[model samples]
Target: MFGIHDLALFVVSGLLLNLMPGPDSLLIMTRSATQGWRAGSAATLGIASGTFVHILGAALGLSAVLAASATAFTVVKLVGAAYILYMAIGLLRSKAQDGVQAPLALAPLPYRKIYAQGFLTNVLNPKVALFFLAFVPQFIDANAPHKALAFIILGCIFNINGTLWCHALALFTGAASRRVKLHPAASLWLKRTTGGLFIWLGVKLALAKQN
Candidate 1:
């Protein structure tokens, strides 16, 4: 119904796509490992909200503009890259504390800040908008009267499934992290390692081609 075809196939494919390792998953994992489940949940909610933006953009045909215009895509990509780089720098600069009331390797961000970070990280990436444009349309019947509605439906399905996976990821990562104690230096290194990865991701996004 609702101008959708191959509903089962869509669900399976969407789940598989959600399982792929990407920046979203990385952010959730990082929060879960370092901060705990609540932090991860905050990140997950932020990401889910951002994905809704993509869904709305796709349904509104805004994503098509990005596909059709090289300039628009480039501008967005550069902005996204810069933001990612800024986050990486923050992580890389985090200092470990010793002999304090509650000494920790990397200071955790407040839930609000973490939530905003997750939202910005997801919203700034034009790739996700493009992804929705490419992926969601396939399940929509071309002859459908309400193609946009169908697209939104598919996007929601994908987002819901992805959110479920993210929560599980956060839960497990947090639980496992609690079981392992890290040296101050090691935790600092962990933060930097993640930071380094974000840099690579930012660079790759900056260099992404419109084609």
Candidate 2:
């Protein structure tokens, strides 16, 4: 009725796509582990907001510019890579307690900051903008007069499902961290592990070429 097609398939595909490990997944899981589920939720909301921007941008045709321009893509990619590496460095050097001489560690990161980080991390990645341009339109009806609305509806559905999955991941990771924290220096190791992953993702993003 809304010029949406094969919505069941889209829903399944979106869930599967959300399952793929990336910065988004890593942030929420690590935040939940170190902070709490609330922090993860903030990150989820921020990421969702960023996805909305991509959806709107795609519907408004701004994403086409990214698709057509290599320089634009490269600029966004490098900025995103640098941000990821920045976060990686923080995680790498952070400690589990708030000490006078220690790095920002497992102590609670402000929800606003986490939210902003989530937004930046998701929005700065040019690949995500490209994905919206490439993926969301397939479900939009070609003959529909309100293609943008249809695109938005589908994007919201996709984001909603993604949020649910992220919340689950946060809860599970938080719970697991409690158990893991029983071991010696588990928190530090987890932070370092997450930092290593961010570094790998950062380098990968830096090396990404426009296709």
Candidate 3:
């Protein structure tokens, strides 16, 4: 049976993992800085909701196939890469039109679209699915009598930890962005940098080896 100690360990691991700064974190930061805390928070919720999807898929053994099949992994990775590249392009275009001096305002995006963006950003990443498959199982001790319950408990803990840390980051960065709103040039450069990072990550992920 899972206990509080296990929960503590899981939370610690999750928090540390969140601090490591991956694609999801970068996405949250970019959206938060470019938009606002509300948008960023929406994206975070989307990501958390996406994690639940992964958990369900993993529980159903769909993620195992994703891990095992190189073709499937590549296909999903390419799709994610494409999406990231598309975002980069959008940023570049926006910068060109806005002359890098425009104030960062929350774009008039529908709430559902914002949420879906977050969900798809996470769900599209094959690496995330693979990570869940590889990471979640280790906490389930073979000796534990209720393996399913243990997996679910640990997964939920991880999701909650991730959401909390990401929300904190969004709040911090969103607030800072407000102070720097006048520096459109700076925002432009930041967008370029963010775009570059996303593109690079997409390329790296595309070239990653399947486990």
Candidate 4:
């Protein structure tokens, strides 16, 4: 069991991290703003599922390989960047129509595909593996009876915090779905903006050095 102080700090830190805007959050927002609450929720769940993989990687020392091997890190990073860029291009090419009913204008794609997109987006980023390797260990107590168990617990806390925030954002976007629906131009701009963000993120990821 972690000390009460450590546990409290972990929760606070986890909450703060989840609040910080990043690719994961952006993906959820884009899906919500452009699609609907259901799509956004699916993306959020997929991202959370990917977090579990990173946590397990960290626990099993697999993340350390990513941290230590520049080649592996670069390979994963480039692949993630490429995938994100592909998504951006798709968004950019989407035709906007007049009288579009906002978020619901486009027929909802299968939730399974959206989920896979979110999951792949998260899992392919080596930076996430590195993040877990660096971030989670800071709160781990060397004197703890079961370090691995503590890691798992703390990682779960991080995932839960993130999921709550993702859902909150999705619901907020859902509430605005009707309003966005009323403005066709606004919907087009939303897609473009989201697409641009993805482009920037892809470039950022491509340039990132292993940390």
lDDT of 2 at 192: 67
Tens digits of lDDT, candidate 1, 1-211: 9867768866865775576456887788778778998888899999999999999987877344543554654465466567667867976886764201211234699999989989999999998987676556555544455666777889999999999999997887788774433345755665667667667766765675543
Q: Per-residue alpha-carbon lDDT of model 4 for 1-211, expressed as tens digits?
A: 5511246755764665565455776677667877888888999999999999998877666344443554654465466567667757866665556324434343567889889988999999997886676556545443344545666878898898899989987878766764543244554555566667667766765675444
Q: Which model, 2 or 3, shows the larger lDDT?
A: 2
Give candidate 2 regions above 4 Å deviation. 62-107, 178-211
Quantify all predictions' global Cα lDDT against the true fold.
Answer: 0.72, 0.70, 0.64, 0.67
In candidate 1, residue 18 scores what lDDT?
70
Query: Lowest summed-lDDT stretch of 10 residues in model 1?
Result: 97-106
Q: Which stretches of candidate 3 lie over 4 Å from their true place?
A: 3-7, 62-108, 178-211
* Backbone clashes in model 3, listed as residue pairs: 100-184
**Which ranges in model 4 have alpha carbons more than 4 Å from their true place?**
2-5, 62-108, 178-211
* TM-score of every model versus the real structure: 0.64, 0.63, 0.60, 0.61
Say what the RMSD of model 4 is: 10.0
Supply the global lDDT for candidate 4.
Answer: 0.67
For candidate 2, what is the lDDT? 0.70
Q: Give the TM-score comparing model 1 with the true structure, all chains together.
A: 0.64
